[model samples]
Target: MARVPQARRQFAAKDRQQARLCAEQRPRAPPKTALGVWGKAAPTPAARRVQDARAHAANCNRSTVVLKRRGFPMMAPGQVDLLKKRGKKLGEGHFSTAVVTRWHGADAVLKAPRQKPNVGQFVKECGLLHTLEGAGGAPEPLGLCLYPLAQVISFAGPQTLAGYLEESRSSAELLRLAADLCGKVSEVHEKGIIHNDLKFDNVIVDGRGQIHLIDFGNANPQGQTFCLVSKGQRCPWLGPEVFSQHLSSPAQDAFSVGFMLDTISKLMP
Candidate 1:
């Protein structure tokens, strides 16, 4: 890991400290599940099987859960076949490809890691989702399997935040959206995960204007620093130190939210 410059590193630390405070200050909403709120579930064995499997939570996690690949229960090939036959195709990203399909007759999306190594990420995502499970405003994590290395999530709308902005002309609505976005990010930060990459393309906008954050491959735990792997050029949502200091934290996430607010400003007027 390349060491970030000390000046930028220090600033990131400060940013994270403030972000933590903001997260602590906000009132976190409880997850809404049929069983009850998160951490308070009395799910049947069958119900538990249908949702969380090992390291993957149907929604979010408080700590990183890493599991060995072998002997791990995986989704049957038949399950994968069903998704392909029943679901529609969604967009693909660098790490994985998604297929929207029917699960128990409900519309669903199956996310499979494109590479073997990325399987760990999908597993991590499950834990994150589990951590956030039953939480209001987050998408439902239907099921996850390891044999075929796949996860089944409820099929959210296909529209991107970028596309949603095209139809919005009201500054009031835009500001509300920005606040909602910040609120969601704050909730995630409180759980100690930094999305690392936050931008228009990474956010999903439902027809009702709800925003869902997607993609966690670049996500990192709060306060911990890693060698900047994407290396060199930084995305527009990234703060200045991302490239210069080579670190990721709640501060970077905070900066991304600011950058998004700036985007909203330019786009509105």
Candidate 2:
């Protein structure tokens, strides 16, 4: 063979090295199996139904027995109705109104749908609260009522972070509150859920200065994709990606936390 130039040989060697590196770095396809590309068989229709039923039963049992064991009993529909008539209105949101009341002699908030169409959202919020039962910084969900479409949850506090921020707060206090909020967000994420709404109004500060996250109506399971429709106003706490891709993730909550911290810093006097 004719003698190859030294530069040509060097170039050929570099090309081979680059090709090998690229091959090594390329993502490998998941191993395929007889059932599916995920290497596991898909559940049959009957099996899927059974799985769903089991999950539903588990949630129902948890909400009833476990909550009762934790000193929060399932209130009867009549009792819930009575509370609605007697309880003091704590606050009102677009979908629901919170009424502060007593449940089994303990402070509780009865959240009822403002309209018939909002019942589904109320139920979802109750479910999310139940899922976060015993979680630090989350209000305990007592139970749900169907007659008037409401849910009773432990009273987090009388003051929201929004109102609390109006008062003069020492730097240490603000830092402590911010830390509590971030810690609460992490706890929610650890439970495999994302608090999509992390604004000041959704956070409650107890008399002891401990922060608790409330208003889980906008929350969704982590990694779920969801579109948030505005109710004639823009949400400042939500990450910009939520508007574009409409995906749910822990990063969204992180962005909200950053916004909160920035706001707190600005308010610091």
Candidate 3:
């Protein structure tokens, strides 16, 4: 073959070498996992924190805000006064009525439902409240009075979460509040009890951001029992798994916690 220019031969060799190297290289791609994207095999503390923050934000957005006020008769002027009522009717729904009250030199919330007295419910709620009270962040169960004709427990409180959100509290504060509430509730549920009527109004937050869960008309012992509330009286939140023509279980209470938290996030100011 005719002699080729040295520069041209060198150029050909260089091109061949470049092609071989390119063939040996791995394909470029976007990361397929969190760790991959973050350049670690596992989540770093900072990454975990970001994820937790986002999850918390999502939880707040999904927190339960629908205050069920049904069936709860209006507070008699005397009962309202007796309760040291403070805030205007925070809300009302089909099963219960909520009033902001001041008791024990602190802001409080009192909830009374129109339904007949449920002693099992009462015990469960009181027990849980008492237990949570021990945690300090939970609302203290000051006392419960059974309304003679109304068959309602005039529950005096720790406080209402709604009022706190209404005041436009911060997410950090809210999350901390939620964590405390979750801890208390987890303890309650662990005891094999179900707060069947778990809802937004039932969770009260006070000026100090303490959480108090209320409304126990539907709470039951850990074991199964016949559904007592009239079919029409059922709170929509009582999931089918728990309230399908019957009373709820611990899972139902857990569902309520999830549902309640979901409601809070949406209502968080």
Which candidate number would show the highest TM-score if scored against the true structure?
2
The residue-by-residue lDDT of candidate 2 on 1-269, one tens digit each, is 45668778999999999999999999998656358556587777898999999987776666566546655446677988789887998989877888999888898998887766464566567777778874658888787755456788898789989899999999999988888888888888999888887888888888999888888888888888876677565677888776655768898889898998999999776
Off by over 4 Å in 2: 1-74
Clash total of candidate 1: 19
lDDT of each: 0.71, 0.80, 0.57
Candidate 1 residue runs with Cα over 4 Å from true position: 1-74, 134-136, 240-248
Q: List the residue pairs that clash in candidate 2.
A: none
Which candidate should be chosen as best, given lDDT against the real structure?
Answer: 2
Estimate, for each residue in 149-196, the C-alpha lDDT of model 1 and write its tens digit. Answer: 678876667888888887747888888889888888888777777787
- Cα-based lDDT at residue 131, candidate 2: 82
lDDT of 3: 0.57
Query: Could you tell me the lDDT of residue 237 within candidate 1?
Result: 79
Clashes of 2: 0
Kindly indicate the candidate among 1 and 2 with the higher TM-score.
Answer: 2
Lowest summed lDDT window (length 10), candidate 1 = 62-71
